[model samples]
Target: MAKYLLLKHYRGAPAAVNDVPMDRWTPEELAAHVRYMNDFAARLEETGELVEHQALRPEGTFVRGDGEGRPPVTDGPFAETKDLIAGWTVIDVDSYERALELAGELSAAPGAGGEPINEWLEVRPFLTCLPTVIE
Candidate 1:
């Protein structure tokens, strides 16, 4: 099985069908959205496809190495950045088609009014380190 990453972006993605911001959602709606995401991951686990999943805080700093013995140089979380990844899910799937199917399912998670959000998720394959012998 090959590993794939499903990336959810906070910015730089096309607008979703249900474009209302989470802040505009009612408390119950927000809760339902969260529950839907959790349930999706749980179902993946049950299917033995889940590798790992994580949600990242929006606040982050850019840092660079500053030579030996020096503290790393740090910069602000630039407000003008084009893309911000909100979260990721890694899964071991048998084929690229399977990964695409899973990503589509995730993009269908419920949003406001319990309607499908139709969000876009960036899917990428992980490069394996193992060498393959050609037949």
Candidate 2:
């Protein structure tokens, strides 16, 4: 099975929906969302299809080439940058069609209302390979 990366992309500003915003959500609602995500993960695990899943921090450092001994470094939480990647999931699948199918299901991950977030996800094939030297 080939591996694929399902990446989350947000074109607009993200809704303030992090776990830290507990004060805004009722306890039951929060619990439900948590349950959904956990259940989804568990289901994948049971199927032996889940490779790995992770949510990434928005913060990231940018390095630019300076043609010197050291490259220039910049701060994170990049502002107004288009095509920002939110999170990713790596799964093993047989073919591109199967990968797409998995991606579609991943996009439907449970959110606050048991509804899809409608956010775009970028699915790219993983290149798992080792270097070879030919003489």
Candidate 3:
């Protein structure tokens, strides 16, 4: 099985059909969206395809080592100035097509008015370290 990453972007993506921000969504709609995401992950686990998933906080900083004896330099969260990644899921699937199918299902997650969001997801394959043997 190959591993693929499904990336959900908060910015730097095409506007979604249901483009209302999560903060603007009604409480009920937010709850339903959360439930749908959880259920999707659970279903993937049941199918033995889920490797891991995570949600990131909007606030983050960029840090760099200044020097061997100096403190690291820190920068602003800069969410407005940069494209923010909201979350991701790693899946081990039998084929690339399977990964695409799973990503499509995830992109169909419910949004406001209990309608499909039609969100865009970036799918990328992981490079394996295993050596290939040429016949």
Candidate 4:
């Protein structure tokens, strides 16, 4: 089995086919979108393919470690960020092909006008930790 991360981006990705931003979507449309995502997750969990999933708020902060004596430096939710990840899903599947197929299914979540979002999702595989060897 292999593990994969399905990254959903709020920005810094190609324009979606739906084009309408979530904030612009009507209340009912927003509910439908959320419901669809929840249902998808549920189905995956039942199939034992889901590891975990979460959605993120847009607000964020950046912090960096300072010298030992000093506290960490805190910074803004930069307007210049190249990418803002919206959320992520971790899935354990049999193969990369299955991961790709799941991502494609997720990309079809309903959007405005009750249509498929047809959004692009970034799929990444978890690096395997090799066993240590002793001479």
Candidate 5:
């Protein structure tokens, strides 16, 4: 089976069909959205397609290694960055078509007004190591 990553972005994507910001959504709407995602994951898990899923906090720190014997450098939470990832799901499927279909369905998760967000999800395929050629 091939593995694919479904990236859910908080920004840096085109506006969703619903277009309403999550901060503007009502509490009930937020609950419903969470429920939809959970239900979707459960179904995928039952099918053995879901490998793992997780949600992330909106903020994150950027860390990089300094030269040896130096402390690692840390940057701000990147609030000003154009792209912010909100969550991710890894799926193992038989074909790319299946992966795309699943991503489309996930992008349909409910948003404000109890409507489909119709957002875009970034699909990335896992790379396999090439066979080594020995002389």
Candidate 6:
């Protein structure tokens, strides 16, 4: 099965949304959301399709090489970047269509009021090199 990456891109600015993002959500709503994701992941696991899944921290540093002796310079999380990725999930599927279907299901993750967040996800296939990618 080919692997795909389901990227989570946050649309709004973190600061502008509220002083606290998830904290702003009601306790019941948050629990429901968590349950939804848990159920979704469980379903995928039962299908033997989920290879691995994880969430990532938003903060990151970009390093640029200067010289052999000089240490690489670092940059921060750009506040102005429009499409800031919150996290990602990896799954193994048979084809691109199947990957898309999985991505669709993930996008339907529960939002407030038990409605689908309908979040945008970037679905990209993993590049395999075992069989000579160049050939």
Scored by lDDT, model 3 comes in at 0.92
Give the clash total for candidate 5: 0
**lDDT of every predicted structure (CA atoms):** 0.92, 0.66, 0.92, 0.91, 0.91, 0.77
**lDDT of residue 28 for candidate 3:** 93
What is candidate 4's TM-score against the reference?
Answer: 0.91
Q: Which ten residues in a row have the lowest lDDT in candidate 1?
A: 76-85
How well is each residue in 59-88 modelled by candidate 2, as lDDT tens digits? 566766766787686665567775566677
- Tens-place lDDT digits, model 4, residues 1-135: 989999999888898898788888889999999998999999999999999999999888889999999999998888756588999999999999999999998999989888889898999999978744875
* Candidate 5, superposed: residue stretches over 4 Å from native: 129-135
Q: Report model 6's TM-score to 2 decimal places.
A: 0.82
Q: What would the per-residue lDDT of candidate 6 be over residues 31-59, giving only the tens digit for each residue?
A: 98889888988988999888777777767
Q: Where is the poorest 10-residue window by lDDT in model 3?
A: 16-25
Model 1: how far residue 68 lies from native, Å = 3.1
Give the alpha carbon lDDT tens digit for every residue of 15-57 in model 5.
7788888899999999999999999999999999999999998
Better of 2 and 4 by TM-score: 4
Q: In angstroms, how far off is 64's CA in candidate 6?
A: 1.4
For model 3, residues 5-54, the per-residue Cα lDDT tens digits are 99999887788887777778889999999999999999999999999999
Q: Rank the candidates by TM-score, best first.
A: 3, 1, 4, 5, 6, 2
Query: Per-residue lDDT for 30-53 in model 1, tens only?
Result: 898999889999999999999999
Q: Which ranges in model 4 have alpha carbons more than 4 Å from their true place?
A: 131-135
TM-score, every prediction: 0.93, 0.69, 0.93, 0.91, 0.89, 0.82
Answer with 2 or 5, whichever has the higher TM-score.
5
lDDT of 2: 0.66
List candidate 1 stretches off by more than 4 Å. Answer: none
